[model samples]
Target: MVKQERAARTRQALIQAAAEVFAEEGFVTASLSTISKRAGVSNGALHFHFANKGMLADAVEAEAAKAVRLITEAARAWQGESLQAVVDATHELTRSLTHDTVVRGGFELAGDTTRRGEPSLRTQWRHWVEDSLRRADRNGALAEGVSWSDSARVIVAATVGFEVLGGDDTSWLSRQNVTRFWEVILPRLAGRQDLDRLVSSGSRPSAVVPSAERTSG
Candidate 1:
């Protein structure tokens, strides 16, 4: 049992180290030896966990996907299928992009043209945003004549833009920036009545449970 636990820890450490290196150096230039060294583990330990750099990148992206799911799920739980949920999720997503290395690294990897894999993080986020907007449409939360597809496109583009810009300027990922974005768009996107209930600045953090605790529970 102890050996298994240690192996698990080592794997996670390697994943984290890889994320840091990938984020800073990009996938094509990042070395497995650098990742293993950053993880304070031997090259053999990294090899035992991940056969190649692609697999390590996949693990980083998978972990990031899980975090994204948790953020959207928490928002939905807090705000149901309303447009407010979409707003809240976007805020949380930006927050993660700003503060979470795994998320940032995964996104960086997704955008790395040198890497051949699909941009799983962006695709997952786009899907969730579209689905959330669709739900809001079904709930009659969207303004008249505003199609969910259009709204989804605008939101996804804006959020992804923020993520990309944030690589050099963290201000792009700030809560204030996200709030300002929602403030501008919510009025045009949400139904007249729903607009009053939506908080462009996002809901209280406590209202949405953290992904880590949610998963453990």
Candidate 2:
């Protein structure tokens, strides 16, 4: 048990170290030796955990995907078709990107053309937005004449734009910015009657759940 726990910690340390490197330096420029050194592990240990730079990047992306899935699944598990849930999830996603190196690196790495086998984080996010908006449209949460595809395109584009812009200026991911975005977009997308039901502040009950509780549960 002790050995297993230590191995898990080592792997996590390596993943986080790689995320920091990858987030700071693009995939092509990032070096495995640097990641191993940053992790305070020997190159052999890093090699034991991952075969190469691509594999280490894959691990980082996988951890990031786990984070994204947590945010999206929380939204999807909401009781009904809710644009509010989507709004909340977007805030969560942005928060993760800002605070979590794994998520930020995953997104950055996903855009790298050189990483042949890695999944596209943007594509996953776009599909989720499209599905969620379609569900909202069916439930009459959307304003009349608003198509889910159109709404999805706008939301996805804006979300990615924020993430990209935030890389240089963290102010882009500020609570004020996210709330302002929802304030501007929600009114146009949600039905008049449903407008009040949405939260522009990006608050979610799920936000109150402790990270340890979430990870354990």
Query: Which candidate has the top score in TM-score?
Result: 1
Q: List the residue pairs that clash in candidate 1.
A: none
For each candidate in the order shown, give its overall lDDT on alpha carbons: 0.88, 0.84
lDDT of 2 by residue, 106-178 (tens): 9999878797565588888988899999999999899998898999999999999999999899889877898
Each prediction's total of clashing residue pairs, residues at least 3 apart in sequence or on different chains, is 0, 0
Error of 2 at 31 (Å): 1.2
Q: Positional deviation of 108 in candidate 1, in angstroms? A: 0.8
Give the poorly placed runs of model 2, Cα more than 4 Å off.
205-217
Give the per-residue lDDT of model 1 (tens digit) for 1-217.
5998889888888888998999999999999999999999999999999999999999999888888888888888878998888888988898888767888999999998977568679999999999999999998989999999999999999999999999999999999999999999999999998888889999865434253552233
Error of 2 at 107 (Å): 0.6
